[model samples]
Target chain A: MNTELVLFGVFAVMTLVSAGLVITARSPINSAMALVSTFFFLAGIYVLLWAHTVAVMQVLVYAGAIMVLFLFVIMLLNLGEAAHRGRPTVTRILGGASAFGLLAVLAVTLGRTQALPAQMSAEVQGKFGTMAAIGESIFTTWLLPFEAVSLLLLVAMVGAVVVAKSRI
Target chain B: MVPITYYLLLAAALFCMGMFGVLVRTNALVVFMCVELMLNAVNLTFLAFARMHGALGGGPNAVFGVGHVSAFFVIAVAAAEAAIGLAIVIAVFRSRGSVNVDDIRTMKH
Candidate 1:
């Protein structure tokens, strides 16, 4: 068995299991913790895909920043006592059915694809996921989008402050 | 060598689970987390395609491609989304005294 494929399987299985926990855990805290682990494992998968920079950012942003925000909000809301795992309603049942249906279709479509060459020339691999390489592209070809995103983030920051401090 | 399809399939599964949570979960915070999951799923797809097509070089030193750049854009956008979304959740909780979505349907509140 190819070591890469084996590692991929391990990370993929772990990621799915963590994600399942994220949705099913009774406490929002538990779900947030599970989501953090899910992000960690997904970062592993991203590295396996030769996206080292993306993987690092995934860990830093998703696992570090995003999950912290999630935990903060969950605690601030004092939802620990509201751990009422409500009885599954009809909407939940339908949701599960549709989710499985969607997965089946995706499997069928993606499985039909032929195997792609997974080997990257050493030269390419060296340059492929490096921070410098990705950054170069971001500042050049994607310069406009990058600036727009910074502006968007600024707007979001201001908007969040205004909304969250409504009564203050 | 893992097949590219495996990555795509996993991303699809992740996206589907996120959709399910968004549809069925009543807690507004959990619903927002699900949205984050969906965004991550899309990011995975972008990186996978980026790897497959070798489209990520743009400088004289780097080859030219948009996949990695696209993933970066998605992450940036997701951060902004999370900020605004959580603020809304917080404001809603303060007004309604609960973060349950079912209790949040009225516009006049």
Candidate 2:
């Protein structure tokens, strides 16, 4: 019934609805656009949770840069609505059942669990969640993982070029 | 204080919606979007824990380590994930000439 809950509820709904649209929308472009909205809603939720840094990165990275790349590819390819209609594949059925099972497990776990007692009431606010703090941490304590991620990106980049580029 | 349960529940719902999208959507691009949704859901979980633990100091110092630095680590990873994932999806679409999962039936019976 408070501001946090109100914000969470709004963003939650936005996330769900846009995510649904991401699947059901006919055009790939439409789905990608819906995904942008979904990212925006997610960023809002992150803001509500006091994750100012993650929220900014969510919009800038996912909704802004990544999405622009997606749009470019979509336009370059000029992919139309897929010609063939789908019939259920075994992968889908199995995947759906597994998802259902996971959902049930999570529901039971959360429904029965008690809330952890609040250890401390940190009333911290914004700007502190800026890029600088994130950068410092990434370079210091998380340097190894950070470097690993860079390596992963490098591999992925090479792989993508290999996969997409026309044979010489 | 917004109970952590509420955030967890929201995360669960988002994850489920994303899972459903991955399963039901024929378009590879939509599937990719769904994956992003799932990642965002996980981010919510991380932020919730970060707040509960005082690890990120709730705002400016909102981080993930002993000294409130791990939070940025997660965000950096997420960025890397998005970049790599979209690149792969784009590459796959280019080669296949379609973004429909159903179109890639080579793995099927």
If scored against the real structure, what TM-score would every candidate get? 0.93, 0.83
Cα RMSDs, all models:
2.3, 3.7
**Per-residue lDDT over B1-109 for candidate 2, one digit per residue giving the tens place of the 0 to 100 score:** 7777777887887888789878877876667778877877777787766665653343333243322244444555555565566666676666776666767877688
Query: Over the stretch A1-168, how does candidate 1's per-residue lDDT look in tens digits?
Result: 989989999999998898898788778888898899889999999998888889899898888887788888887888874546545878778887898899899999998997564466677667777888888888877788889999999999999899999665
- Candidate 2: C-alpha RMSD to true structure equals 3.7
For candidate 2, give fnat to 2 decimals. Answer: 0.43
The fraction of reference interface contacts (C-alpha pairs within 8 A across chains A and B) present in each candidate is: 0.62, 0.43
Q: Please report how far candidate 2 places residue B95 from its true position, in Å.
A: 4.9
What DockQ do you compute for every candidate structure?
0.63, 0.44
**Which model scores highest in lDDT?**
1
lDDT agreement of model 2 with the native = 0.71
Q: What is the interface RMSD of candidate 1, in Å?
A: 1.9
What candidate 2 gets wrong by more than 4 Å, as runs, is A116-133, B56-96, B107-109
Tens digits of lDDT, candidate 2, A17-114: 98878878888899899999998998897776666777887788888877887788778778777666567778888887877788888988988876
